[model samples]
Target: MDAHSAPLPAAAMPANGFGRFAGHLDRALGGLVETVAALLVVVEIVILGAGVMARYVFHAPLVWSDELASILFLWLSMLGAVVALRRGEHMRMTGLVSRVSPQTRALLEAVAITASIAFL
Candidate 1:
């Protein structure tokens, strides 16, 4: 509080309470989904590989391999949707939208979020 005291840098300031908690939840959820996806992919690959090797070497293919792989693929794809949200890698026409007013931007964002949620 002294006049001569050096000001703290922005990074040294305490994080916004809500923002910090939101970030923590986001990271935790992302990590959990990532782990599940990884495990699913690994399991599918191992099972499919084993099936292929067995079929080639012994002329025996497990009937369940294809079904198992398909189920895993579907589940993985669904879980993978959150990855795009987390990465902020979605495609958008920024050039056109950048010139819009803040109110319009907020409206567009709300509409987009609504549409995305409805679609899912």
Candidate 2:
């Protein structure tokens, strides 16, 4: 059978205690990241709106709003990335990997993860 049609190996299943705990942790962290990203987006919108109102309607600019909005946007983007990664929704070029053997795929994934950790 091809990789796509093959059943997942037993080791790939999250049936053990540590695997369950890790899954729960990932979900919790993903939820937190989503919540924080949403809040940041709201705050950014409010700050931008207030800044615009103050500048055009009141003829006085809110000097700090722009900087605050930028910071909020940065955090929002980072948190969104975390959420995407947790959900396995992040962009990837998987065409070549999909055609490889399972062992090779696993090795490549391990190396990629290690490189990511080292880079971080």
TM-score of each: 0.67, 0.71
User: What shift in Å separates residue 4 of candidate 2 from its native position after superposition?
Assistant: 8.7
Worst 10 residues of 2 by lDDT: 1-10
CA-RMSD of model 1: 9.1
Candidate 1 C-alpha lDDT tens digits along 5-111 = 23445587559998678768877998999899899989999989988988888798888888988999999888777765555544455665577887886777677
Best model number under TM-score: 2
Return the lDDT, model 2, position 109.
71
How far does residue 73 in candidate 1 sit from its true spot (Å)? 0.5
How many clashes show up per model?
Answer: 0, 0
RMSD of each: 9.1, 4.3
Q: Give the lowest summed-lDDT range of ten residues in model 1.
A: 1-10
